[model samples]
Target: MFTGLSAFPLTPVTDHGIDEESFAGLVQRLAAARVDSITALGSTGSYPYLDRAERARAARLAVEHAAATPVIVGIGALRTRDVLELAQDAQDAGASGVLLAPVSYQALTADEVFGLYADVTAELSVPLVVYDNPGTTHFTFTDDLYTRIAELPNVASVKIPGVPADPGAAAERVSALRALLPASVTIGVSGDPLAATGLNAGCHAWYSVVAGTLPEPALAITRAASTGDATAATAESERLQPLWELFARHGSLRVVSAIAETLGLLGHPNLTRPLRGLPDHDRAAVTHVVQQLELH
Candidate 1:
């Protein structure tokens, strides 16, 4: 459940609220592609913007539509009590695991971060993936903190943000982090553009954003890497370099929303208020890239 490719699907919503049908379609698409797992309400899902009920609904929809694939729900919230509630909601929804990042408004000390994990993990019955997404959480975990939190019960995997760009450096970094963590806790790499590099360097899994909307290309890379054909994995990822460049320019959330919209998998104004999809010109660029790359 924690390893290989865990696709993070966007939670498409409308003025009326959760778009249950579209969300289910997204989950089902990933499941049909046989992604290693489905993660609902991750940062890509715009989780922080959704209320408890909405997030709970999204979790349930993901689990229900994901077929036999494992589902991991993101249970991150600003408050510890809320995080616990979300965790319980995910568990009740039958999530195979839960992904948690230490969400906060104020700056949190390392001790506070560690305490957050301790408090939440104590209440969690299912396995927990330590989400180290500094991009959204604004809380960085030191090696010492990772060591401490990973020592707690139910710590199944560590979702590291990304690895170094240079292959040697990436390998050494993952190797050193691997030594710090318990063998039971797998290391999954995020940052879609660097996924191939990280996996070739030693990451056990890829927590991908694009995979949610387009699973075929993602599966190609993951299968290649997992099967020990690192060259094929790198080539496949490089083949999608245009998409990665767009993700760098417009932010993955907006770029992916555009892709889903372009592909007609989601409706207009699908995102919550104040967070619109890409502009017309940018979307035109996306269409050109999608066609040029022949992305389905």
Candidate 2:
């Protein structure tokens, strides 16, 4: 299971195809920074936007350049068979583990979600991380459902999104989850803005979006929180409040892509069409935040 900061890099695309050079550079940068792990084909990576071939290529490239760093590939698909195939491809590509989310067009029942993970887990060689992002999946997991999934074979961790507005409530929720889940299963939190609160709440890891470009600060926050240094962690989190505000206003995908482009971390910040980059105003806002933070 992945612990600490798992940086999810954006999938830098070009007019032709995946920008291999830029993608590899990003992976190398994360590896150099010594992020706990790297997740390719994540939401930030725009996994759903790309075809299977593109996703497979991205997985291979991530694993290849990740060096000693463990790589976790997102194998989320609407269909069970597609998810299974992607999981197998991730294993073949030398990925350390796979992240699976219950994604569906029609609303999914708890039983269906359980069956999806049960079937996928039975076939996978590596461990699976259960992704619980209701915002996108539209399928929320009750505590009972999470307990059932945690009992599944090879399910190592659960990635829960934090409630940024209510850190106290989020901490209590984390405590409840910790009590419900087995000791072996790690609990990680996503949604970068909520990370400090989540980490302070005793989350084992932070699945961060900003860490994809500016890992130093992200790691600093996580490290402080993980070590029980509330003062330091809160200070670091406050320091990045400007960038987090941008993430809250404009979506993280747009703002982070713009920040990466502005920082020259990626060759092009172009997202797969239909999903566009930040507009001029938002781009200016992100640029100002990045410069103010001296992120570049």
Candidate 3:
């Protein structure tokens, strides 16, 4: 249930709040494309920026609109109490699994992070993903921690921040993780650009940001890589290098918001306060990249 091409859609919020219409449309589009899974409310979904009520509502909309595809809801919160609440909300909303990042203000020790997952996993009826998102969450996981967490009940996957770019290195990294993790706990690669290398190297899943908006191309890469067509998969990823470059420059969240707006998938200025859209010139660059690449 936690493997392959898990698209993380933007929880496109407007001034009025969670744009149910647009967010639902994004989820529906992903379902239609036959993505392996739809992961709502990841970092790309701006989970940190939303309130509990908005997140619960978005989780419901995602499940309601997701059709037959499995829905995995991001349930990360600064506090364990709130994380547990969101996980319950996700289960109530019919999520196949829940993603948890040890969101923090102060630096969290390995024990603290593990304790967070331990506490939440103990309460979960559904499978839980250990969201090792150091970029946003500012906490990294050691292999020792992964082994310990994998032993927890209902711990299903580890969404690693990324893998090495070189195929050999990626393979080595994945193999090492596989050695530590239980057979049931899948390893999913999160960084979109290295998804090809990771999958080709034997990672079980691609927890993607680009796939959330432009699923076709992301699907193309995933399908190619999973089928053992490593060349085609790498080619497809390279083809979308411009988008990846934009992601590197403006961040995937902002760049994808621009793509969504450019494609008319969502209205402009969809992000919340303190998080703004791309500048006009950067937006124009996104438009050009979209047109040049014939995305959508």
Descending-lDDT candidate ranking: 1, 3, 2
- Clash count, one per candidate: 0, 0, 0
**lDDT minimum window of 10 residues, candidate 1:** 268-277
Q: Which run of 10 residues does model 2 get worst, by summed lDDT?
A: 161-170
Q: Which residue runs of candidate 2 sit more than 4 Å off their true CA positions?
A: none
lDDT of 3 at 119: 92
Tell me the tens digit of each residue's lDDT in model 3 across 45-106.
Answer: 99989999999999999999998999999999999899989999999999999999989899
Residue pairs with clashing backbones, model 3:
none
Please estimate how well model 2 matches the true structure, expressed as its whole-model Cα lDDT.
0.89
Give candidate 1 regions above 4 Å deviation.
none
Error (Å) of candidate 3 at residue 64 is 0.5
Superior candidate under lDDT, 2 versus 3: 3
On lDDT, who's better, 1 or 2? 1
Candidate 1 lDDT, 1-296, residue by residue in tens: 78899999999999999889999999999999999999999999999999999999999999899989999999998899999999999999999999999988999999899889999999989999999998888888899999999999999999999999898999999999999999999999999999999999999999999998899999999999999899999999999999999999999999899888888898987888899888899999998988998887
Per-model RMSD to reference: 0.7, 1.1, 0.7
